[model samples]
Target: MAERNNNEFEGKQKNIQILYEKFVILNRDLLNFGVSIEELKEICFKRRKTVHTVQGSQKNAQHSSFIVAVTVVCAVLISILLKIIFDSIIKNTLGTRCLLPNNYFIWEATRPETNCSMCEDVNSVLVFGNVTRDEFSNYAYSSRPMLVKGAALHWPAMKTFTYHFLKEIYQNVEGAYESIEEECQILTFKTEFRSLEDVFAMPESRVLLEEGEKPWYVGWSNCHPDVLAIMREHYTIPHFLPEDAEHAHMDYIFIGYQQGAVMHIDYISRLMWQAQLRGHKTWKLVPPPDCDHICSGISFRVDPGDIVLVDTRQWYHDTHIDAGEMSLTVSSEYG
Candidate 1:
């Protein structure tokens, strides 16, 4: 029995030894697995850090691009605003200076003596009546101007010559007349064609006659021979003119209110006679440069039933009609 007990104890000790060896192997395998798991966790942490850094860099690049775009837009808008203001100021200053005649800066500097003592108060024009041909020749040769009373007072035109009468005669006639597009010197007068009916139909507002306003309508009657012939029947030739000049009938008719021709010298070869038939007109005449010593600028009013003979070629003249009514004057040119 004592021998059996000793063998059993040895067997039990072998079994215990086998169990201890299995525990040691299991512990080693667990340690190797734990090391592999730790390495994988470290790799995942580095990859996450790299992704975050790349996202931060991309976000910074996008923010920088947005800032640059906004700055460029603001610069373009400021430049356009300055250009508009400068152009407006230049247009107003130059346009106003051109319309004024007496106040023109360039004329004041260049022709300072134009309105000096020679343009002060002057005498009335010479008056004549029933002048003979010889008397007219003498006056013409001496370059004298005269106002003949009753030159057309007794003519049929005194009662019949009017805007309506003339319009009737030229209703269908194709004619050209002077028209102004604007109140500026560059486009003061231009020739336009229209029938007499169209002219009579123009609105009153378009025919400006007030001070500082440009006249819209003005013209000579020489454009149409038929119209000229009709005008000759109303007023007879002055007896003062020679027989050769009798056939030289009236060639111009001025029809307007409160305004007349601009200051200018006529370059035509013949002397001119204007017969006032309807309204009052004041004439302002300036002599030629050579005649300035003997004559100053002269101003006189011509009433209805009066005729004025002037050497328009040798004088600078302008006219102004009274404001109440439209004025009518028939004029002729003769040597």
Candidate 2:
């Protein structure tokens, strides 16, 4: 009986020893898991008799959760601030442009007030035989729709810019045509081609205006550096523009048969000058929809080498190629 009693006491001592060892390991683990040393001690030593009590441990865990939430919220706020700063820097550094699509910017810009008085006395377009820089600045800079005769006659593009010539250059220029598919804008004015890829992939015989070929007209912006470089070599800014006038970095190219564009206002930034390189295009300029009563609309024909200037942003206009060869025009904006 005495030996049995001694064994029972020894077993109890061993069980308590194992429990104390486990508590020591748990304290070490809690410290590693971000629990404060004080809190760990309170959990372990203050309740040495009640090892299952997790009150201090729970408090530490709650504090840790709060700190994690605050850190996450601070990170989100910091990310938003950085994005705003980056956008402002990009806008200021890159010519104050929003770096968005042209259409997006146009939609954001407020439409200019159309002064019907400007178009009041306009019976016909102001045709300039030889417009000096001063005359152009004063008369046709922004208020009047004018045409400068023979403005682009010296350009090599007058005779050389044909369907095949343009198509070939766009194909040869590295990623020139592909850029349109990716980022550049293309207008399939009255055509079935949904993308530049579809336009370029069309059969050459149909593109050549053969018998009964589907007549198509398409317009696209030449934004690729290499493509613009080659095109600039063929043409240049009109000589009559104001000395300090600034032009857009890119130029618009319109090519194909008749049905140029329906009467509509251009959603561009500033006044535009379009050079008729091939065929004859007639311009019908109308006042804004709101000024139809006070303003007078007029029609004029733009011949090859003639440069037509208009504040297309304010005027509703249309164009239809006169019966002639395929029409091609290159245009850019200035202010």
Candidate 3:
């Protein structure tokens, strides 16, 4: 009887333990579900804040983009308006020539006092005197243009290459005159009957002369220092840069003649002081103007002993010759 009772009690105790385990599992599941709900609410709140921040940023970006577009449009419009205004003003100012007397007809010098009387009377171009040759030859440089009529003369330093080319010309040939082209020959302008003193002192030599029964040109060639030295033996001073002209320097003198009613072109570089030794030379000039297309050639006369300088790219000019005589000019290209 006692054994039966103990076995029944043991079975009852096992049932109680099983019920306790079932209750513990249900309680754990409920606690986990509650924690999950709280975590979901926290995530939803954070997402809301993030969405609001993104919306604000998008609105700011749109506003900034609109401002940039407006600024660009305004800038373009202003630029177009300014361009139109500037174009109209320039077209009105420079498009037409004035009827009044053009003052561009002046002597080629700093001062107009030295202009020849014949050159002064006409509306022709005039070349002017410069700082004394002595001043120009030295470092005492002046911006003054030597004048002929009332125009300004310009002088620039000579290039080293020009001197080299001159040396080549001298090294290659011999004679008093050399022909670079059949149409033009390098020659001297010597005159007779003038006092040996003044005649020898100047580089003026007549290029035109009577040969036999016809008037033929006496050609001079390959003018070198030795030839000039020889000529100096007969003449006085030939207005040339001395061998020791500078510390260690030399120069080349190129000769050109303006045929009757010929156009006087400005030089590429360097100021050309053209001395009128024989005959008269008329010049017309237009200062450097818009794009260099419009050429203003004013007429002017240059007389003997009158030095006129054409500053580099100064103007377009021309000359007229007496029926029988050729106009003589000496162009010195200085550095």
State the lDDT of candidate 1 residue by residue for 1-335, as single tens digits.
33454565555556556655754564454344432434323322222111112255765455344333422332333233334334433444334422343332543344323333333334667787776678766665334557888777887888888777776766645542221112212112222423334556665554444555444434444445666667777887776777666344337777766667777666555778888988898888887565577677777888898899877666678888887567788877776
Clashing pairs in 1: none
> lDDT of each prediction vs. the true structure?
0.58, 0.74, 0.37
Model 3: per-residue lDDT, tens digit, 4-65?
44555455456556555754564454345342433323323222111112356766555445
Candidate 2 backbone collisions, by pair: none
- The TM-score, computed over Cα atoms with residue i paired to residue i, of candidate 3 is 0.34
Which regions of candidate 2 deviate over 4 angstroms? 1-113
Candidate 1 local Cα displacement, residue 267, angstroms: 1.5
Worst 10 residues of 2 by lDDT: 95-104
- Per-residue CA lDDT of model 2 for 1-335, tens digit only, reads 33554565566556556655755675565566666666544443343221233366887556566444534543454455455555544444343222333333454355666677767777888899877777776764656888999989999999888877887888898898777765568888668888776877889877767887887888888889899999999999888887788888889999877788876677777789999998898888988756778788999998899999998877778888865457899999888
Better of 1 and 2 by lDDT: 2
TM-scores of all candidate predictions against the true structure: 0.53, 0.66, 0.34
Q: Would you list the rank order by TM-score, best first?
A: 2, 1, 3
Question: Of the candidates shown, which would achieve the greatest lDDT relative to the real structure?
Answer: 2
lDDT of 1 at 105: 50
